[model samples]
Target: MPGIRFSAQDLAATRFTCSRLREVVAGVQVLKDAGARAIHLPWVRQARAALAGVRYELLSQLVPMPARYLPDFLSPMPAATAPSLAAELAALTATAPAAVRAQLERLPRPLPALVADLRRDPAAGLGRLAGEIQAFWTAAVEPHWPRIEHLIDGEILYRARRMATGGPAALFDGLHPKVSWQDDRLTIAQRRRTADLVLEAGRGLVLVPSVFIWPGAAFEADDSRHQPGLVYPPRGVATLWEQGAAAPPQALAALLGRGRAQLLAELAAPASTSELAARTGQSAPNVAHHLAVLRAAGLLARHRTGRTVLYVRTAVAQALVEGGG
Candidate 1:
């Protein structure tokens, strides 16, 4: 199992971030899966149809197999709080020719001619690659980004609460079955081989929660050039692709009006008014009215991020949903 040995300094410097670039990179893998493991994601099905006209063959060739170790230049550590896709694509375009060749040389198998061309003229090659990525995002990701962002934000909030209440160890808890934290060492169970990394001052672990990298976790700590980080799937991902609102329990539906009760039940995971309306087949105005009523009653809480307002069940509401109230 590969383990990251955090010195006292490293532990103190560890931090968490929700990276846009990382998500884009991981999303490519999800597309490559072709709904095999991500059977639950109905969005993937739609995305595939949307992307049917794009140059998917070339894009998939660049990503290759063993999707974990993608070229670092393509998805560098995000620099801003919320990096725009343009910014991430620019980073890919900026890769030096030599660096691109170096990464290609490290691939386990012989490089395809298209990829080898990257070594000859990195700027042109990377530009083409960036265009492919943009096309993919526009076709497969942009339309679904709001729902995806909501899920990511909810995970971040959940982790923040875990850290606040239980400290560092709590942060590692339930991250993945293969990951464990003990005696200041963050261990990741790996099949290939064993390795250890000691973080120096100013070099901290970046914890990134991923929606696409499901059923397993990945650790990358050996690269001295980049900040070490772990990419693990966020909780509640199984419900990510669920198509429509489930029927509320009969008793609960009878107690609260069916509309409000259905909204409450769906609030088990955070969702915006638009998302709720889309899921429930209700108009946005109607959804907002129900949400406001629930919020006034202390059954739900509203969180504003950017221009979007997300609603989640409060403990009182959760109890009600669970049939306790």
Candidate 2:
């Protein structure tokens, strides 16, 4: 029952951002925990194949299957809204040795030797930890990084619009069933502890949408934080690896054609041309052409975030995609 008691200052400071590091850590966690596999079965199987022989024993042990608590340092809150792997890894590498040891010492142990070594020499241990994560990313994450990034970006965009139109409730309510915002406070349900910790004067908050953190959510707030963060699974993880296009209502497809219908079917969660291309096995130019036509027909709404322009179904498009037509 841990919660963040937000002040006016905390609410003003809150913003949306996504992380690559979190997904990397979550991917490792999925591999370590057997029961957690069902949440992202497609990803777990694909990652298991990709991570073959990857030296993540230390990383996996640290985030054991049925985790009690994962050390905060692994999922560092990046200063940037959308941080690259290098930036996240650098943040991990720069952790203060004392902070690292304190978290490790608190772990339920007889610690693994590597973890013990890490607790003994945090600076050196940090280097090894970063090395393993970087290796894991290179092997399992890099190939799918674009699709993951786009999905998280689209989630932020959808939530941003929801907050703008419907205020905080619309934004927080969709995050996870266990996460809820009332008054100015945000409460996170924990599996074990029943006590809630309130932060009266938080610097800011980051909501990190993860492709791997499905079926659960995690949040943190402490004096050490410049910003508190909640990492929740993004909304459309089920479609991340899915290839079957949504069956557009027959009438809609008849009007829009099979190609554009397929494109429309896939945009339930906004995506860029490149992301759609990858998702549908189409060329980027082909996706772009279809998106242009969809926009012209008033069936899609385009919104730009950073350098990417995402397309989501307009109300009309939504009805059609749902077979209203």
Candidate 3:
């Protein structure tokens, strides 16, 4: 079979790299050389799991890490392309379950419109909004903590880059990647392992399914969006398991301290600095000071709404909340 032609829509549709298209072609040859019969694409894996009627846990190991390497191809697009859950729920309500539909109704309505605005105008400054929605989902899923962790670990196994230089722990610690369970398959979307913006997973042609390919890279929807997507060929595979050996108690404390706890509790709903202050019972200025500190820590972020700055916890922050570490 001939290779698929590339286009801008393809670039935006998926999340992996196209610059190394030749490498992908070569990798496919290597896969065929290895005597593997039918190759399982990323989406196929996901669909298989969904058909099982249970969400299969992907690479959960990587979920604890921060999103260190985001694709630079479309940095200007919103971090999340899909409109807010509220918006998607409204669209899917007719067919969605009552429980799921109710969950969607709980979200703020304007969130999706704001996301669209950010997508259409890069300078709209919706990063904070993105952070808030992400936080909300993180917090909302606490009841399903075990399942989420399993999904992340599954994603790690599916997408974690197999490094020749170090073991899984070292590579995981060093890279600090994000893993997710999409369509019931675990997925690891590549991020900058370092400042170079090199596609770490793509470089080795490992079994790491390129988010850039099939389902495309699932970024926060900031830029790098295209359709008909690009894919990275598989090579070696690394497993993402739960962080087996626990870190020291102090380390855990630092991760889920008073500040993070307070922030997570408040971010259940998007709130401005003043609103957060009111909720925390702290003076507005004092609340503002802490908000700034949290944002710098990447635990909380800010968004502009009208004349005020809305603050919310980040996914990492919620991870700490969920992990209690």
Clashes in model 2: which pairs? 33-65
Alpha carbon lDDT of each predicted model = 0.76, 0.80, 0.35
Question: Judged by lDDT against the true structure, how good is candidate 1?
Answer: 0.76
Model 1, span 37-132: residue lDDT tens: 565367667877898878845456667646646677766665555678898788778777877878777765667777777767888888888888
Q: How many pairs in model 1 have backbone atoms within 3 A of each other, for residues 3 or more apart or on separate chains, i.e. clashes?
A: 0
Compute the lDDT for candidate 2: 0.80
TM-score of 1: 0.86
Q: For every model shown, what is its TM-score relative to the native structure?
A: 0.86, 0.89, 0.24
Model 3 Cα lDDT, one tens digit per residue, 233-321:
22111111111222323444465555435645555334566545544566778767777777888987565533655555566776765
Predicted candidate 2 versus true structure: per-residue lDDT over 1-325, tens digit per residue: 5676777777677888878888888887776663755756776778789888889777877887677678878887777888788898898888899899888877987998889988998988889989999999999889888788888888888888788888877878868988888877677887654666555564768888888888778776542654767888887877887765565667767888977998888887888887788767878998889889989999888898778899988778888877644
The predicted structure with the larger lDDT, 2 or 3, is: 2
After superposing candidate 1 on the true structure, give the runs of residues whose Cα lies further than 4 Å from its correct spot: 5-13, 56-58, 250-257, 283-286, 296-298, 315-325
Candidate 2, which segments miss by more than 4 Å at Cα?
Answer: 192-197, 254-256, 281-286, 323-325
Position 10, candidate 2: lDDT: 72
Best TM-score among the predictions, by candidate number: 2
